[model samples]
Target: MIRTVLSLIPAEYARLTPRFLAAVVAQAICQAIAYVLLVPVLKSLFGDDQAAAWAWVAPMLVAVVGVLVLGYLQSLLGLRIGVGMQADLQTRLGDQLNTLPLGWFEGRSAAALSHVVVDDVREVQGLVAYLLAKVIAGVVVPLGVAVGMLFVDWRIAVTMFVAAPVLFAVNSIAGRLYSWSDRRIHDAAVESDTRVVEFAQAQPVLRAFGAVGARNRALDAALTGQRSAIVRMVFTAVPSLFVFTILVQAAFLVLAYVAVERVTHGPLSAAAAVALVAVGSRFIEPLTQAAQLGTTLRSGAAAVDRIAGLLAEPALPESTTPVNPGAATVGFDTVSFGYETGKPVLEDISFTVPAGTTTAIVGPSGSGKSTLLRLVARYHDVTRGRIEVGGADVREQPTVTLLGQLALVSQQVYLFNRSVIENIRVGRPDATDEEVRRAAAAARVDEIAERLPDGWDTVVGEGGASLSGGERQRISIARALLKDAPVVLLDEATSALDPHSEAVVVRGVHQLSRGKTVLVVAHRLATIAHADQILFLDGGRILERGTHDELLTAGGRYADFWNERSRAAGWRLEPAPVG
Candidate 1:
């Protein structure tokens, strides 16, 4: 545990660690000295040596003062290191998250990460600020006193040495048990938190389906699991604590018995034996603290393990000498990918989009349409082949340079809780207000602003809940327009809009894609009928590749898909006769 904490401290604060530990050890030594002096002081006073008793008291007072001063310094250093360590851990986590592949952030994974950053970091911070100091003192003071006892009475010292190891072994076993329980409870808590967030976010759908309240089985199950885990933790903790406490008491009893037996056997005087018995509590006190602190230290160790695990997650390898792309073309050579091994999502897929040309991919649900666009953007590296943008392998190019070369408008749009104009400016942070307004006008976001209560300055709620779906899409389109990169990737950008809104958004998309390398995932076949090239994808492979007219004439899978969609387009509901 000590090694884990020292490894986590930031470089700037590393020098303070040795100083802090020295202070802790000094304080523990002084404490043991003051306690040991009690035995000699009592023995002298009982023997009627007033001068010798007073002599011992003087140095004992000084030792007590030393304990106080060193303790103060240790606390100051611990606090400084704790605060710095917390901030550094948070920063490191942020940096790691930035380098991780985007596909790793699934819902449960995100929730668990959030818990680690907030709760686990705080727990580990407490380890340095409080528990670490206590732990050092607990061990150091006890060992120092046992050695001190050797000078006063070897039999008592030997008894303490024998009991110390037994007590330590018991505490070690109990600590492991508590740590295991802590990790289980931590996982269950994260799972419960994920379910609660899901329940809240999905309220609209749940209510529409009449599955709200008691009918929401996922939420109920999650909460039940959390309760069960906590109950198990309590059950595990109580027995471990009970056994540890019993062992601590037994050790104290054995030490007291040895001191009394020494006086009976004529190896020690009554005054010395009584003093030994009195001073024995001081020896056992540190051990008792160890027993009491065991659970807390185990919990902190669990938190530290979580932090270490997150920091240990592998980041995508970045190129040492990054290269720049030479063109705006995109190509995939026999690409294959899967979220998990032995289960491929895209297999042996190959395609190329020439510079300044438009290619549309149409496929059934789960046919890897969206996955194709994600791969081009390098959201995840290819499993078997290479993806190139502008004739440069994406893996060889710096992430910033690769992302800067293209504009993406995915189906799932996320907007910050900021003013409408502010959200639109995210595409180009340094863009002038005039430039932002111009892009908004092109995307028809101006119409949305006009309807909002505060026009362009209106604060959109979280995820743009304040605006309609079509309004959010318009704002998204405005962002892409402002970016004005050489390449564009649209993942069904207009799928959520009405016909009128869709037409307006399409016009904005056309304006944005003019003279750019465009690759689109199109669900509406009619919308992509005029695309320069079309690829009919299904089951992770392209079954047909040609112009829309050529695919229709071939009378294959694309022809059948197009005919079915055309028939569905003209279908209408008829009024039924009254019963």
Candidate 2:
């Protein structure tokens, strides 16, 4: 288990090795000195002429005071070092997580990562302080006691040496069982976390479907399972304690009998015999504590394994080449991709949008319209072929550099729990208040802002739940306008808006799209009727490419789609007015 934990230590912590080793050495020396001083004092207290040993009192008192002072200093230093180490661990973990690709987050739960970051890191400090300290104390203190016992009688020392191993063997067996139970407890904890997150995220849906009671019961079951596992782990330790107590008491009883016999029948002094029993009893305390701490260390090792597993997940590969795209043209060159292998969502597709023009992508559901936009943004790497932005292959470019050139507004907008101005500032983190207001005005969000109690400073609720759908969409568009990147990608950006809101957002889009490369994916053909060019996609293949008037004249997929959408919007084909 120690080997396993050692493997998990981050390379950045190598600098701390020397200090940690020094701390262990200091604790060992302190424990040994404490036990050595304790033995002579015990003998002196029981001397036949106690009044004559008054000189020993002063030295013993000084030794006790010194031990306490050293112990307190050690604790303070250990706590300081532990906290420093934990801070470093958290920083490293956070950095690693940030560097990882978005796909890594797709398969893992936020709650599980939260546990690793917050709970598991805390356990490391507890393990270092309690387990490492106790183990050092156990070794040095017991050795000191044994040396003291040898002066009294080698027989008692040998008896203790034999009994210690027997007790250890019993504890070792129990520790194995405890380790297994601990694993189950950890698993249950992760399950409980997952359930809580699921319940929280699905609360609205569950309530809408009248499944809240079922969700509550499921969460209850998860908690119950976690509790039961903890109970089993707690009970597993009881047997180890029971065995340790029996073995330790038996060893002391045997040592006491032999010590009395030696004092009465041989040259051993009575004071020495009593001190030998005192030393023997003292050994049991550290030994038992060490056994308990050993279990704690094992449990901590398990938590470390879990945390390390998360950190070990492969992060997004870093790009070495700098991307300096002179033009904002976006293109896909025979790209193929799938969330799962062998079932391509997009296959051998190719397209291009020239700089400073609007290119609309229209497709039926599941035709990979949004996926194509994601490809252009490089959110996920293609399984085959390459996508280029500004005439440079996206894979060769740093993700930051690639994404910096683009602004994205999707069907769903995620707003932070912050003021409207603060949320917009996420796009251009250094934008002035006036610039923010200008962007909001351009997106038509300022219309609503004027009536808000605090205007742009009004706090949006979590996920912007307090805002209307159109308000949120406009806020999202305002963020994009604030970014003012050379390229813009909009995926059904106005889907959630009412007709009036749609017009407001459409006007904003028109103003925002000027002199920028814009790629829009929309199911509503009317939204893209004015687009400079439209590409009609079906089954992940482009079937037609032209303007709305040209595609309508062609009488193909685009024409049929345009007609269907127009009819849905209550437009009647009035025989073209005999033109």
User: Judged by TM-score, which candidate is best?
Assistant: 1
Q: Evaluate all candidate structures by whole-model CA lDDT and list the values in order.
A: 0.88, 0.78
Off by over 4 Å in 2: 1-20, 33-66, 129-131, 143-218, 228-273, 291-299, 338-345, 362-368, 528-579
Candidate 1 lDDT over 474-530, as tens digits, reads: 899999999999999989766567899888888888889999999999767655797
Candidate 1: regions farther than 4 A off: 210-212
Model 1 TM? 0.95
lDDT of 2 at 348: 82
Clashes of each: 0, 0
How do the residues 302-322 of candidate 2 rate in per-residue lDDT, one tens digit apiece?
Answer: 778777777787877779888
Q: Can you list the residue pairs that collide in candidate 2?
A: none
Estimate the overall C-alpha local distance difference test score of candidate 1.
0.88
TM-score, each model?
0.95, 0.80
